[model samples]
Target: MAKYKQLFLMGLLLAIVSCEQPSPPATAEAGKVAFNITSYLQQQRQMLETRQPMVLKSVATQGQEPEVVETPDIDWEDELAVFEQADLSRPSLQEFYTRQEQVLEDGSTAIEFTKLEGANPQVQYLRLVMSPEGKLKQLHARLEDKNIIFFSRRTINLSTNPQTGDIADYHVEGVQKMVLGDTLRYEVKANL
Candidate 1:
């Protein structure tokens, strides 16, 4: 009788263990990265800080002459922040954009990401040109945001020195319109 009781308890324990629910599957999709734009920009920022290169900046607005300046003391982070906003590597945005890659005739690689239909992302398009050695040659992005009262759109282009992998020039052009105020158009270009 005692032997029978021990066998019953063992069978009961096995049954309970077998009935436990299985653990959920790992999230493989969340780990996918189209491009690590944020990390790349951060690295560029650090390099620029160390080099402290002088920038020849030009700014122009509607109905106004362009203003140009050359200075070594400027906020690199702030200047680069606009590019950072186009980063699409966030987990939440993984499904919002589609990526395409191709090799150009000059042996460079072009990777582009475009927003999918019905997906309202701030960055509508992004393209990156990489050299044969996998160095960034150029970057371009278009961003747009609209609300009931205001609308804004910006296009950014950045070029890097092939030999040194440093930013050689960049341009930012945008338009802003308010419900009750005049439309504003501006352009900013910087050469390093």
Candidate 2:
């Protein structure tokens, strides 16, 4: 009788353990998010091929005083090519497979990726914000190069026409620190 009671308890424990829910495949979901972001960027690239040049302002400062100097407008005709040349490669995409996805309070979605495997292995993070329909809305990236003790950040915000799905306007801001012992900052805002 005692042996039978022990067997019953073991069976109950096994049943409860088997009924527990399993975790979702995070990597696969992250990959899907990354693919969506890449597709949206590709669409933007195609649109940029036919758009006119954009206006930009640049500034630079050195040392700790943080003097802000605003420069005149500059034509940014080659920025699209620069973005394309980055070549969202396979390894970089793999990094996104480990990212986290969340929905913001404003009903937008955000995907964030971090690569801090080592002190010098591109200690960086990429955050992408998109609309519910998967349109790219904003992108922010921070990258650190430990070898040279350099840091850089880029922020881009875009608005699109609801009916036509065309870009209405965009603003881009960038900063680089300790780049060959100099600091630089730039901002670009354009209307389509």
lDDT of 1 by residue, 116-165 (tens): 99998899999989889878899999999999999999999999999976
Candidate 2 C-alpha lDDT tens digits along 23-59: 7655575435353434555676566565643533333
Clash number for every model? 0, 0
RMSD of each: 5.2, 9.9
For residue 108, model 1's alpha carbon misses the true position, in angstroms, by 1.9
Q: Which residue segments of model 1 deviate by more than 4 Å? A: 1-32
In lDDT terms, how accurate is model 1? 0.88
> Pairing residues by index, what is the TM-score of model 1?
0.80
